[model samples]
Target chain A: METLFDQELVVINMGLEDFAKTLKERGTRVMHVRWQPPAQGDADLLSLLDKLK
Target chain B: MSKIDQANKEAVDKMMKSRPVWVDIGRAKDVIPGMKDNLFLHAGPPITWDRMSGPLKGAIIGGLIYEGKAKDEREAEELAASGEIEFAPCHHHNAVGPMAGVTTPSQMVFIIEDKEWGGNTFSNMNEGYGKVLRYGAYDDEVLNRLMWLDEVYASVLKEAVKLSGGMDMKSIIAQALHMGDDAHNRNRATTSLFIRTIAPFVVETEWGKKTDYDAPRLDLTNVSEYFGKNKATAAAEVLAFMHSNDLTSLNAIMAACKSMALAAHGVENSTVVTTMARNGTDFGIRVSSTGDKWFTAPANVPDGLYFSGFKSSDANRDIGDSVITETVGVGGFAMAAAPAIVNFIGGSPADAFDATNEMYEITVTENNNFNIPAMDFKGTPTGIDVRKVVEKNIVPRINTGIAHKDPGVGQVGAGIVKPPMEMFIDALKELAK
Candidate 1:
């Protein structure tokens, strides 16, 4: 299983604990975690993903 | 015929016809009658001035006693009611007042003229808050201080202004704005800078006057600390700056906020609000794009702590021109910069952050100078936009002082509250016009 952090997902609506647990269940190590709400009116998920990367 | 039209007309008329003249300290004598004895001038839209707030009434009574207008408060009140004394707003008379902002004919006024705009403004001497006249408390001590300000401080300022060739307040305001002051509530840095620039000249003038001045006997040590030491002086300086521009700076913010909110006015899809103001008697507001109409609700009682011996019961509804600051993006909007203010209004550091962040949902820009360091150097949210307000369903927050709804109680506590949204909706209807 791949670590969630390795897959680079920007999680919204999920708490840090739940995301970490889900990643562990998948046998993937999540690293380099940061959380911030999306900008007021931006809609580009890929750009958001690029920012996370 | 609409209320918005009437209010807009009144605002515009005041703005256009009133030609503010910048007067030299000495020349100000001619414009504002009996100004040497009392240190304050009136302000706001010129109109038929009426009975003042209780604290203002109290201050005036104290001024009357100080000026020997009456032997006591009862006598002074009787004289004031009898119309023996004329009433005027600090703005109308080219002056600003602190606290009760009361200035009788005998008061001295600091006069600043806008060289470019030809606008002039006045402010009375700062009495320092806490059971003072501006807060509507009238007593022997308040009266006595008025006497000193009139007799000693005003005279000193007059001489200093003459010797220094006149202080350019406009320059000071520009600098202050750059240094994180919205030029209303947060003015510590500006006040300090003013004293630093003028202290030398004040001392020199005292030294030059060998006879009555008694230079050696003069207490000029804290003269430069006027803003810090005296609330009136700080307010006076700001009033002078605001008056000089014909309310350009303030009106700009108001108009900008109005324009920004215009986008969402009358939108069938939105429930956003736009503007709010308290007229001392009533709190009024408008929603996005809803032009100049005001739907007023009873002003709310502010929640916060009071000075020793004072209780919330003694406070008045929120009042003053300071609300203009909130319209354009300062005051409560920038509370994070003044965390200590939370003590006055009641809140925590986290609350301050929350206040600033909440403001962003309703605003258009972030102020460059007035910033919150605790929030990682983020600028204070600048403008309150209606679209965002409706989009996020966030009500604008205001940190305000509660004055006694009655005249005499003065101020009780500082608290946070929301302006009624009904006014915004009314304004939204006007925007449809």
Candidate 2:
């Protein structure tokens, strides 16, 4: 059986703070994705989606 | 398969087969049996009256005032202390609520039905923004808003749903997960999708017709009014409210997740966790192997950013049943898919992805329904095992809103919380038995 320690880690970095920092300091690979609400949750933009649909 | 593997498979299969849909709105007393006049249901595990936390007490008082049992907070508190008012966990009644999470007999709850598993679950309505009753604020403004939601909002939604023949909640949730919402603290995408789906239905509902059959045929000022001129205002208000509150879909998502977890409950010899909740006083978890019994520990205060003028010291211990989102693989477990959640939950985008990656270590499998695009469309980790969690030394990571420690003070901030390891240790021991 493959154990947790034997597997490689792939990290998703929401931002470079706190928990992600600790993981990076320990030399784990991290991938960062800049996250924000879709279309900034704009009412006009959302209504536009309604139109498209 | 080994005995443990077979048990785990049985548990995961039920969870995957669950098809929860938001079917109706119901009063607690009507849909949930044993909900009497004095009974008030809260989040997390069962707790005694004296041991209740401040926000919880505040919610009970608010529930009393909302139900007309008492005129004010003082009278409400007295009624609660009189021992006539009963307190119970929402989970005990197939219901869940956020914050003080007090679900009273009169409140309207979203009723989610699981077609596959043949059960229905409920969650109390969400009060948008701060100073609402859910966080324990029970002033006139809060009461007025609750009354409006119960009287006006619920009726409009119920009619629109009936006219439009209801919707599939799982479809919206699956799309929301794809569109970058964890569906707990951040629901921008899901909120937009829900309002967009229902706006047309709401428009179909004619105002004044429900009240008067002979309601005057409007001599419209503008014939070009595409939406009924009278109903446009109501539709506008609903859309605007949903737009302003990013967490509007939270209650529905929770109801859906609860349905899935309910299906996973009561499987013999399975170590899968069915519920992870906090009642501000204690953190509790229920394992599939152990049935309804709760393994609890001292609740931990969350670590995250505090709103302006509030310090971490002012925050209450973790509270509410919002963890249902995480229990079925959305919320914090899918943080990598919703990097934007860090803005509300207080972390970096990197932290969000790291959290999701770490969760895979403890969970039994990834959920096919909730997929993360950033991770090559990998499903969010699902099926928490008491045994695996103990062996790996990892507790479930939770996304939560922080309430004030003092009653009626309302929310202070939001952040990440972890269940204590001790509860899992107790659950593992139970499984061994």
Candidate 3:
């Protein structure tokens, strides 16, 4: 049953703020996504982390 | 089998063999033999006038006019008070009615027999909502439609069902359960299967061919359309199936849920809870491992979306036959699979997931067939265990149709709600005894 939770994942568009708030309230962990043109993979990841802090 | 197992089996067998008497009402005396006045017909369980909400009262008034017991709303009220008519639960009579579930003596009823066990059940013809009789709006139009159904539709269906060698409701339900229907709120799959199975016979009926009659026809207009077209037909078939197999496991689900909740039912040390049920008056519940007694409390208003022009105030407290679903681990427990349900019950996609996840804490089994893909195909938590409930201090969640506490209100909306904890406490006390 615990393993069932490990496999469960959810994806949300960056624009859904209310959805994010709801998720946080429900105690679900979240990861932020940075907006960038396709191909800026690592840069995008770093910027996303910076935005999170 | 062990002695306890034998007793359980016998109880289950008695339930399986119970049957309803069939009556076609041409007059009120035909059906209301023992019923009391001031009572109204509601589906599933018996409820009284004081416990009823606004819409339910309206339905009772509407029934009076439809039965010619009164000429106007004021007259209807007086007649109701005069104790001239009778009121009884559709369930007590082995019958089920749509929405407000008002069935007068003149209304045509389909008396279905479960050929396997000899158990029988009844249901009145469906009156499509929107100012219909079941919702307690009685006028010439409602009366006229009722007349048409009794005269034409019931006759056609009676012959059609007989012609089809009787419907195999058990098979239909088994298939529907797999097709995303709990067979309570989401009857689309069950409705479609019923039409498909019965269409061949309905097409052969006299009513099927006449263009002048303009009666609602049963056609394969897709699954959703089936619910709209011949709801009564579908309801009858489902009821028949439910009554057929003694081991249909519906009550078993309820028992299982109760037993699981027993673990947490009444630990002075525990906060986790277990059971919930509605007696049509007060909603009641029990905690895990607490026992068979119910702790009852007044039901609360449901939080959800309503049909157009309908408001929360018009809705009744939560009611229905579907609480068995919560006992077995679906309905609100599996909200993630039915995201479209959010539109009817006021919730977001995330709320749906959370509801499903929260249920996992108190339940025992996970249903394999009723899986949610968004949750990585995890099965909906199935049996609510009392131990888990007590350990976790969580009550089971239920998504239900809110009937107007008043008879005429019909259905106000669909929403998520919880059962009162008192029932569980009561049940716990009994078990402790």
Candidate 4:
């Protein structure tokens, strides 16, 4: 636990990009995953996706 | 694997294996299939004079004046609206055009043949830039330039291409990708390579080689006399004209891309997109499985840096058939290969990399030939699958030249734009059925 606290924290931030940008600005190692809600969170397209499965 | 998956694989394989070679050049009326004297081919889906944008309308008017169908702008406009002239999309005849994408029958076209698939595609000659016919400027100057290109320049280029056998466009594009060209908005490297490859052959043209089978052999010892001094002057003029314009090869490259895309079309049950083009007013796409059916939507305006006297508001909606580059996985999808393009299209080098990186999320696979060194030599994200586009809700990115909204004003800027997502969703809906 103490070693974990002493080491630099690495982060993978998803969804909003600004969160990752803020983390990197503070000297943290972070990777931003460019993300979006599948089908852009549309209900009808989501149901249609169910048909594909 | 699912049927769609297997079918899409076949389509992409065909696209990747295409070998487009510049085989010949001729007038559109002579070479293009189904092209006729009264028929004019514009870009994107089928549209009428009413729905046509200012740039496209202006180009049609210019085509009339050039064809001698009308004497002046007023007569041209009346003739265009009189319903005497027939209009169709260039894609209907296996052809592509840039900017306003107006191709009249009298214009010269580059004939590109797919050596692997045996299909031929065509595109009209590029008229350099600014106040050109493609961008809707059709004054006496534009018409005179077109006449020269259609007659003098076409004859010279035709002889050179015939002498060189055929220019391998696929290989040139592959090499240009490495030399900082996306092969669409940034074709500086492509144009340079084109000039280098054709310059030697241009000089050796059979300019004055005369033959009379029954007559006595004339003394033809002098090389300059054999290939007339007129030929030398024309050859020098041709090379200079080609060098003066950085986009000399754009139309040729567009034809090559169309050839590649056409090879991928007509595969059963595939989700691969085979065409993406806009005719100023509307954007349209065709899928392999759907055949010739076009799913269309209203085009969105571009956002980017304007010229010295222009702003974003002065720009028209996204235009041209150049987005065919993006469909075949270069253009905007391969921006990482062309960081220098940011100066013309607006953005930083990092933004360019990010743009390419984001495209991978929605594409089916990376290309085999178009490798980007900036991405650790990774291939470009290729094959836009309709299902992936809808599921991810991401639209394909396109780099384009912006024309002025009003006719005759010419290009106001260059920028990045995206087609409306509705078309992809509509395509997906049809595929699902």
Candidate 5:
């Protein structure tokens, strides 16, 4: 088993798309989460997401 | 609100309230204050001709020929390199340019005045895309089109705009936002909307004076039917050019954007960004609080898919004043408004949506006027904050056309570019000072 220090650090790019490209260029492992506004930013749906959160 | 918050709010509100009027056409030296006869303005930050990029040099040569200062390209090159002509940044003169972004003294520029803010901005007219002066192509065809725009289209629009009063640019931009126009890279919708807004007035205005040239000239007394007489042919030519060039309204829209952004440029204690522009060699940004000082870094070439027969190696570094749209919260920051733009930048609809959504992270507020439908009527992001940009480590993304690396060659691709983070860091450090 590889130790934590020996393992590659992973980057989770939550929103901005430029980050993923920049991180990749610098040789970082990045996972771009498909981050969208809650329920397509619907006011009523946002309250639902808020309750769920 | 706190003092800083209030200042930022006032700045953004002033920008949002700006109402640009299609005012007039005039020579750059007469219209733009402080424009000297020997000086030429280019886009992004300032640089002398020796260090200027290929496209910029090409545009300078083209402008010299257009102004009748030089007989041909070879002579123009010598004059430009002889330390005879001075170069200044367009931003310094309340003007903006696309691509090479060259604005010369004799060039007739579209003046967009923000009536509500009591200020004005200007830009040179657009020549339909491929092999045009803006992208550094200085062929006979490009020079001919420039002459046509200067003598014909500029004269026609000057009269028509006066006849129609001022076409309300704010409402058109508001409507275009919903109709799939990011108003930057993908402006087809905005161009069409602008045409619709002005076409009726265009036909009503008289065309052509009896000039010796066979081309469309404005005849003060020769009033006629919509398409019945020679004067009608003049109006027809302007309309024909409009219909042919999808990028026709880009320069007009850029002027409007510049007017809006200029409204927010001088608010004290506000870290809101007022400009992010590139001249192919350097990318520079201005912060509202920092006055007009520029924080610059070498421009980065965009990474994207190219047009057929062109590779990344053939592409010039990113250039243009079109990013004025991004500064005022339209371009890539509103990409979700024009998801179809993904095709132009080699991305998916999801990528487009993500780009706009992500912009919210670094922005100070959302534009209440420009609402995005797909996002359930949420306002698009607005007011880039230098502090937030550095803290979050994000920069504004620009959707731009890629020109060829060598002079006289035209656009090679369309792509997205981000100004260097260093400029934001530098701005933030200065603001802290």
Candidate 6:
């Protein structure tokens, strides 16, 4: 816990790209994952996809 | 592995193994299968005359004029709306073209054959620069340039290509990726290599000499008069024309990519995208498993730097079959290889690297042949999987030339754009069914 806290924090920002940009502006290491809601937030499609999996 | 995963593997394997070679040049009417006398082939999926965008509509009008079916633009427009003329997608005929992608009966086309798959693809010969037919300009200047390409240019090139015995387009594409060409919007290196490879043969070409060639031939006997008396002058002029135009190899490369994509088509349950094209009005995609069925959505206008006189408002919606490059993995999927292209399409070098890096998230594999040196020789992202696209909520990116919204205005700019995500969702639903 002490080592973890002593090290720098790196974030993996998903969904919103601006979050990653803001983190980077604050001099934090950040990676922006271009993402969205699975099946574009369609309830029926998401359920169908879950069933298929 | 899951069934879809196995199928996707088979589909992408076929794509990677396929080798496209430039075999011949001939008139579209004589070479392309199912090409009818009055039929005109345009870009993208089936779009009616009413829904056709300005560039596509303008190209059709110009095609009619060049075919001598109409004497003027007014007559061509009337004939187009008269419902007598038949229009179909170029993909329907085992061919692909860039920009407006309008192909008429008399236009000469480059013939590319897939060595592994035994399928042939075709594209119309590229007209070099300003006020060209591919971008929808139809003045006498455009027609005259088309005529010159059909007669003088095609004749020498046909002989030169035959003398070189089939240029390996797949190899050239792989090399171009390393030499700073994404092989869609930026093709300076590809064009240079094309001119270098054919220059010797272009000089050796005997205009009137009859030679027995293996591929289907277009009878240029009548047009031999266009070559004139001087051999050196003809070769010099052809070289100069190719040198001046950086897009000389684009149409041929599009045909080659079409052959590559067609090889991956029709693999049982594969979700790999085989075609992604737009007709200015609608963007459409065809998956490997779905066969010929197209899922379409409204095309969005590209955002980028405009020319001196044009603004974003003047730019048309995304257009062209050139996205076939992205489908087979080198256009937008390999942007890191060509960082200089950012200057043309309006982005920083880091943005170019990010563009390519992001694509790997939605693709099935990395292309071994098209590796990027900037990213430590990492292979380019290849084979777009529809399921992955929906699952990850990411869409494929394309960098392209922006045509003017109004026809005959020519190209306004070049930029980056993505097809609407709804097309992928709909395609995924269909695949599930």
- For model 6, the superposed segments whose C-alpha errors exceed 4 Å read A1-12, A27-37, A51-53, B208-232
Model 2, range B129-156, lDDT digits (tens) per residue?
Answer: 7788878789887887787566556666
Model 6 compared with the native: what TM-score?
A: 0.92
What fraction of the genuine interface contacts, i.e. the true contacts, does candidate 1 reproduce?
0.00
lDDT of each: 0.50, 0.80, 0.53, 0.87, 0.83, 0.87
True contacts kept of each: 0.00, 0.00, 0.00, 0.47, 0.00, 0.33
What does candidate 1's lDDT look like per residue over B340-380, in tens digits?
Answer: 66655676867876677778766655655345566676766
Candidate 2: clashing pairs of residues: A12-B353, A13-B349, A13-B350, A14-B348, A14-B349, A14-B350, A14-B351, A15-B348, A15-B349, A15-B350
User: Model 1 - which docking category?
Assistant: incorrect
Give the per-residue lDDT digits (tens) of candidate 6, residues B291-314: 899999999999888889999989
TM-score of chain B of 4: 0.94
- Candidate 6 residue pairs that clash: none
TM-score, first chain, each model: 0.28, 0.44, 0.36, 0.72, 0.52, 0.64
Model 6, C-alpha of B158: deviation from truth (Å)? 0.8
Mind giving the per-residue lDDT tens digits that candidate 2 earns over A1-53? Answer: 46866889878977335767788899998766544443345554444333322
Worst 10 residues of 2 chain B by lDDT: B211-220
Estimate TM-scores for all models: 0.59, 0.85, 0.62, 0.92, 0.86, 0.92
The model with the greater TM-score, 3 or 5, is 5
Q: What is the DockQ of candidate 1?
A: 0.04
Tens digit per residue, CA lDDT, model 3, B1-433: 5332243233323222322222222222244333344345564344555555455567677777766778889998777666555566554444445445666666665554544344344456665445566555666666766666666656666666767776555445446555655444555565667667766776676554443444433332452354454543433432333233222222222222222223223333222333355544566554333433345667667777787777887766665434645654566776776666676677687887778888886655565445666677786776554433433446678777666555444566777777654444344334334
Query: Residue A6 in candidate 3 has what lDDT?
Result: 79
Model 6 fnat value? 0.33
User: What docking grade applies to model 4?
Assistant: medium
- Candidate 1 ranges beyond 4 A from true positions: A1-53, B1-29, B32-53, B63-71, B82-96, B114-118, B161-188, B206-280, B284-297, B368-380, B383-397, B401-412
| Model 3, position B209: C-alpha lDDT score | 44
- Could you give the interface RMSD of candidate 4 in angstroms? 1.6
